[model samples]
Target: MTRKHIDCRSFPSEINCSIAISADTDRELLEAAVQHAVAVHGHHDTPELRNQLRGAIMDGPPTEEQPAR
Candidate 1:
């Protein structure tokens, strides 16, 4: 199966979060993202938040970036 990924660098953040997560399944990716959002980004764990995270899911592995601004 094609891997899925999510990148914090895609979004604008004051902390300049550079985390990139990849997984073999949606369930795994969502769990990791939820933990990151709550523990680091100070976001609450909720269905709405999970939905947003699910929306951000990418089709394949993440690519390298220049840097976060």
Candidate 2:
């Protein structure tokens, strides 16, 4: 299966985050994304946030060109 990842540049953020979180498994990716969201994005870890992060996961790595925000 394709690797999963969450790229900060994939979404529009006030901070214009450029980080990308990737893992071989969904559990690992979600946890890492949660930590980054909490630590760097100053977001509280909530079920809703988790759902949002889960939804943001993509089937591949970050692209050289970010999608238009």
Candidate 3:
């Protein structure tokens, strides 16, 4: 799997930021990651947010649930 560039200059208060997702990564995915960081990590402002998203790159695509085959 490869990585993509994520422009996360939206919030502006993150640290050691990196989306760790892909550029093509959707809003829901991005939101989930950011929310996770904000909720879990100490991302409260622009810098922190930025850091938390600086090298943001996608590791793998998200997975959806499925019934037993």
Candidate 4:
């Protein structure tokens, strides 16, 4: 299994936390992870959070790159 970190900034408030998951390289898995993060974490309806997750997925697994390339 692979893992990736989702960075969340803390400026106005200090609660810097990184979400680490078995790195998802596909859209479906990525979508599931994003939904889980939003529902489990307190990042619902947040564009930044969604973008960050999408970016992480795009970054791809350490052993492989996105097929779209």
Specify the highest-TM-score model's number.
Answer: 1
Write down the TM-score of every candidate: 0.89, 0.87, 0.36, 0.40
**Model 2 C-alpha lDDT per residue in residues 1-69, reported as the tens digit of each score:** 688898888777799999988898889999999999899988999999999989888888667777554
Better of 3 and 4 by TM-score: 4
lDDT of 1 by residue, 1-69 (tens): 999988998778789888999999999999999999999999999999999889888888988963332
Ranking by TM-score: 1, 2, 4, 3
TM-score of predicted model 1?
0.89
What lDDT does each candidate get?
0.89, 0.87, 0.46, 0.49
- After superposition, candidate 1 runs with Cα above 4 Å error: 66-69
- Best prediction by lDDT: 1
Cα lDDT tens digits for candidate 3, 1-69: 243334333334446333333444444445555665667565564665545554454345422422111
Q: Considering lDDT, where higher is better, how would the candidates rank from best to worst?
A: 1, 2, 4, 3
Which pairs of residues have clashing backbones in candidate 1?
none
Candidate 4 structure quality by residue, lDDT tens digits, 21-61: 44444556567767766666656757786676677553433
lDDT for 36 in candidate 2 is 94
What candidate 2 gets wrong by more than 4 Å, as runs, is none
